[model samples]
Target: MTIKASDLLKYDITPFLFGVLYSRIMPKPTDDSNPKHFYVYTAFRTSKAVLKTAFSLSKYASRLVQQYNSLSGYPNWEIHKSSDNAIDLRLYIQNDLNIDAAQFYNLVYKKLRSSTWLNTATINEDKKYFLRGYMESRGSVDTSLKLFAQDYFYNNRFELKRVQLLTDDIGLPISYANFNPRNMQPQFVSGENKRNAQFRINLFYYAKEIGFINEYKALIFEKAYKPRARIARDGIIYFQISVPNLNSHVAFIKYINFFTNNIYDKVLTPEKVGILRKQIGFNTSQELGQPYRNKSIVDLFDELSEDKCALCGTSQTFKKKANGRQSFEIHHMIPFHNGQEFDNIANFVKLCPTCHRSLKRGSASKDDQIRSIITILGRHPEVFEYTSSALGIEELPKLAEEIWSLLG
Candidate 1:
C-alpha cells in the first residue's frame, strides 16, 4: 500500500528510515549481557538534513544485525552545536521497560535484511509508527558493503581505502592487499597480539555472513574466496587473494559502485523515500545534503578537524566514556550561530573536551575566535569559500581579510 506523509505526522519518510537504521547501525552503549542499567538516546540533525553521525560515536558502530527498541525516554538536552547551532540530542535512558536488544535485533534484521520492511506496514500511519524511532548517525553502509564484497572475491582483510585503491585497470578490485597497513615492523606476535590477529581473521568470516552483505553480493561471491599464502614484513605467513579474472572483478566492481554511488537517487521515488522513512525510520544524504561518498575519509576533514589541538598543540585527551567511546566531538572553526550552517567537515574540527568547550564557550570575541580558528585550520582561507553559503560570515577580522585576499 502506498503511504502518505500527511497521514504519518508529516515526518518525512527519509529521516525515519535513517532513524531505524541509525539505531541498528550506530553503536550502542549498553549490551544485553553487560547489565548496564541505561543507554543514551542521542539524535540531532539539521532541519534540512541529518548531521553526520557524531564522529564520537562512529568507531563502535557495527554492520552486524542489531535489535532496535522503541524511542524510549525523553531526551534531556536538545541543544544545538554551539559552533553552528546544528541540532544536538544527547539523552540517557534507563532500562525502565526491560527492552530486550535481542528481540529488537531480530525484528530489525528480519525487516531490513531485504527491504521487507517496506511492505510490512499496511497503512502510511502504521509505517510511520513502525519505522520511526530515535536515530543518530549514518552507518558504514557503503564501505561495509564494499569490504564484504572485497572479502568475498579477494579474501583479504578489508581496510578502509579509496575505491581506486581497490580497483584496477578496469576499475575493479583485481589487485592484492599485500600492503595492508601495519604500524610496527616487528615480525612476531604473542599473547593478546596473537589473539587479536586471530580475532580479526574471525571477524572477516563474521563480516561475510552479515545479512546485508549476502543480500547484495551473494551471487558474485557464491564461490568461497580462496586465500593464498604470503610472507608479511613481520616475517609471518598470511592469507592473501585477488580477483583473477576481469569479468569476475567487473561484477564485483559493479556491486560495490552500486552502493557507493547514487543508488538512492536512481532508485528512490518521493513515495519510496517517504515509505522508507516511515518504514525504516531513516533518510540518507539524498534527502539532506548533496549525495556524499562516505566510504572515503580521504580529505574529509580540514586540518582543523585533526586530532591535536591547533591552539595549544595539545594531543587529544584520552577520556573514555562509560559507554567505552573515546571522546572526540566536532567543533566548527567559525561559530555556527555567528552565521554558519552546519556545513561539511572542511569547516569543522574534531576536538578534545577542554578545547572543544573553550571554543564553544562564547567568551572569546568573534574576531579573536576567527584568528584562533584560522590558525587551527592551518590558516587556509579556502574554508571561508567552502562554507560561505552556510557561514554567511558577515565580517572577517583585518588579519583574516589579509589571508583571504591573498588566498583568493
Candidate 2:
C-alpha cells in the first residue's frame, strides 16, 4: 500500500489479473487431445447446469439445508458399526444419502419397509446424501424427484385396487375388459369357481399392463380354452390334426395376431432382425430341407427361411444356438398328412427341436394342441382371420349372422 506509482507499474497488475481470469475460465491445464478431457468437460457442464437450475428452486434449497442438519447431528451414523446388522447399515446409508420421499417409498420394494421403520441413524444418513446431491450437484435427484411426484401416486392407486378387492371379500373382476367379440363369449368361465375367478383377475392385470384391449379379449379366450395334453418333451414335434372349421380358423387368427402383428414391420428392424439371425445360428433353413422324410411338408415350407423352425405347427428338430443359427427342423401341419376332409391353415404350428423329436415318434398328438389354440382364438375373429390368411390358410371359421352369439 505504501509503494510508489512506479513500483506498482513494475509489479504489472494487468498480467496478474489476466492469469487469474484465465485459470478461472479453464480446467487445470492437461493434454488438450486427451479423450478423458471430453468426458470431464461434459460432466462439468451437465453438473453446472443442474446446480444452476436446482439452486434457483427455493424448495430444493430449503430441503438441502434440512438434510445437511440431519447429517451433522448424527455424524456417527455414517460409520460402519460392527454392533449394527446389515439391514441397519443399509438403512443408515439410505438416510445418509438424503433420499427423497419418492426414493424412500421406492425402497419399500428393495428394503421391504417404510422410512418410519428405519432407525434414526439410518434416516440421518439418507438425508445427508440427498442434501449433498442437491447442494453439490454431485449425485442424482431426478429419479428420486420423479418417484416422489409421480410414480408414488400410481403405486398408491394399485394399492387401492388391492385393498378394495380384499375388503369387499370379492375377487378382482374383468369389469374394465371391454372387448366385443364377434363369435365367442369373452367371459367363458363365469361360474362359482374361485380359481377361475382368480385366473381372470390375473389376465386383467396382464391386459392392463400390455395396454391392448384386443389382446385381453384373446387372453380371455385362452383361459376358456383347455389344453388337450400336457407337453412332454422339449424336442421338436409334428402335429397332424383336424383343420379348424372356418369359424375356428377365424378365431385362431385373432389369437395369433398378438404374436405376429407388427412382426415383420416392428420386430424386423436393425435391432431385432439381428436377433433372428442369431436365433438361426450355424444351419441354414436350406440345409435342413434335404434331410426331412416328409417331402411334401418340406416342399411346402422350404421356400421360407429355415431359421424359423416352426412353420404351420411343426417343431424344429435342431437347437436354437447362441449365435442365432438353427438346424434340422420339422413341420407339424403337412399338406399330405391332412385328411381328405379338412385342410385349413390354422391346423399348422411351429415346434422347436425337442418337440419335433416327440412328434415323429407319435408320442404327441396334434388334436390336443389345436383345441387349446382354437379356444384362445374364439374371440377377436377379425384379427384372427387376417393372420390366418397371411399364413396361406385357405379357410376360416364362419362368422355368425348376428352379433353377441356365445361361442365356446
Candidate achieving the largest TM-score = 1
Clashes of 1: 25
Q: List residue ranges in candidate 1 displaced over 4 A.
A: 1-306, 322-326, 338-341, 365-368, 379-385, 388-408
Task: Name the 10 consecutive residues with the lowest summed lDDT in model 1.
Answer: 194-203
lDDT measured at residue 197 in model 2 versus the true structure, 0 to 100: 12
Candidate 2 weakest lDDT stretch, 10 residues: 36-45
Cα-based lDDT at residue 59, candidate 2: 31
Model 1 Cα lDDT, one tens digit per residue, 112-194? 32343344323233233222231112112122222321111111111111222223211112321111111111222212221
lDDT of 2 at 246: 19
TM-score of each: 0.23, 0.18
